[model samples]
Target: MNEIISGEKILVTGGAGFIGSNLCEVLLDSNNTVVCLDNFATGKQENIAPFLKHPKFSFIQGDIRNLEDCLLATKNVDYVLHQAALGSVPRSIKNPITTNEVNISGFLNMLVASRDHHIKRFVYAASSSTYGDSQALPKVEENIGKPLSPYAVTKLVNELYADVFFKTYGLETIGLRYFNVFGKRQDPNGAYAAVIPKFVKQFMQLESPIINGDGTFSRDFTYIDNVVQANLKSLVASSTSVNNVYNIAFGDRNTLNDLVVYLKEYLAIYKPSIEKVPVIYGSERVGDIPHSHASIQKAKKYLNYQPEFSLQKGLQEAVDWYWKNL
Candidate 1:
């Protein structure tokens, strides 16, 4: 929290969405004047409603695909936390054109605007999916494989564009490759909703959620708070080189079955019958990674990032929030 540079003007690209809204809240709490630019395509209005009246909070309902929106939102902003992008590997497979248009084209637009405005640092969301089919257990930044899906390609392209912006245009940039980030306000109703929230919702309804691929596929389930820490560190720290990418994760892996167990355990406090809920196994979805893990050495050594929430700790908090809010 002390890392925040008070009074600095920060623009968060997807300010009405899950990760972006959390970033805006933290930045505003730190006394930074924050501007949010979102088109509401996937970002919900309810997510940003709490901050609509804040003195330091400004909202611009705009699309990143349009360069004019980027320029207007970035004007006079000191830093840009670029979190606006279409997510979900399955969704991208179904619609690559839209994903490319938003993730890649829109990302370039933000970079151009940030460069023109001379922003201090451009911290954008990268993805663990960039690892693709590499078969690496603890994913390192340098190692990667051919992207398995359009979504992976888009995120990887973001890293490339950020690197080019820093080298060619001299815009300082850092990319955080997030791993299975989950927390409150994350949309759980969508077809592409993340596993944790989706399962939480299903269990709340006393319904069984389907687990893909025998429930053995594991992921480094990072908590959103840890991701927030990484973003804040990258925004304020000069420890790492510009145009770099680091894995933002809990540095621990959990199987889908393991995740359900935790959710039931925590959620049972509110809905006693949820503990008896069952999960069915379905055929593995195409473009799904078998197992994923991350080595946080780079972020730790460079940005001094110390993840504050473990999977269990984050689940406790998330379950509590969902029970009260849902």
Candidate 2:
């Protein structure tokens, strides 16, 4: 396994968002100088607030959509972890044009800037949505079905772009196809908020959380720390690991009902009344698959990636954080 010990100056685009901020925090703690580029569109200011005065950490208030900003951010950087994108399937369904402009076009801008600047490696955030309509039990890297939504299309295009960048410009790249990641600092108030944090918030407030479908739908819910490990490993992995996408997950699946049980169990510790909180059922979301599981074997064999947090372990940590923070 490769570890980022110190001394590398890395640029993390979208470093104000949940995942990006976590990456920034870890890098800084490892004594690596970090430049965070974010427009605060979907990213929160509070997420990056603590790093404001750190000597080794710098913030660039910019959008990836602009080639100039991407060029500026990648300058003199050893590596680029590109996490800037408009996420959420429903958000893409509602405003695909903006999603395309940000996720696809913005991704291209970052690629060009990284290539031009001669960055050592570019590790980017790919999505499990790229699996699309495939019915595979544990989604492998090569077997992908057609994209089901604009968000999925954008992520798939990112893989294509990264592949071309590596082949055409010799810009080494690794894409991490993240599963349904959840953990601390994840916003739970938005319309497109992730199920885990959203439910935690609802339960904290003694409000009923709505579960789409009959609660049989399942997903490979990865923890943020696991994702952070994957990103750091991608940064330092050998040449053989570059130019390929790996599924970053815990290699397990759980239904919505299962998730609810865990949430209620964890939160009931904070407030015993939360145990009786009712869950409402609603229609299944469009662009949603019935089940999602990941094959992390490739990641382990190639990058020596080993995830430490299971869904239950991560949920306990998340519930604790939300209990104190929210």
Candidate 2 lDDT by residue in tens digits, 199-275: 99899999999999999999999999999999998888889999999999999999999999999999999799999
Angstrom error of the Cα, residue 8, model 1: value is 0.5
Tens digit per residue, CA lDDT, model 1, 1-326: 44656789999999899999998899888889999999998889999999999999999999999999999999999999999999999999999999999999999999999989999999999999999999988999999999999999999989988888888988999999999999989998889999899999999999999998899999999988899889988987883556799999989899998999999999999989999998999999999999999999999988888998989999999999998899
- Whole-model lDDT, candidate 1? 0.92
**By lDDT, who's the top model here?**
2
Query: Where is the poorest 10-residue window by lDDT in model 2?
Result: 1-10
lDDT at 268, model 2: 93
Regions of candidate 2 where Cα sits further than 4 Å from its true position: none
RMSD of each: 0.9, 0.8
Worst ten-residue run, lDDT, model 1? 234-243
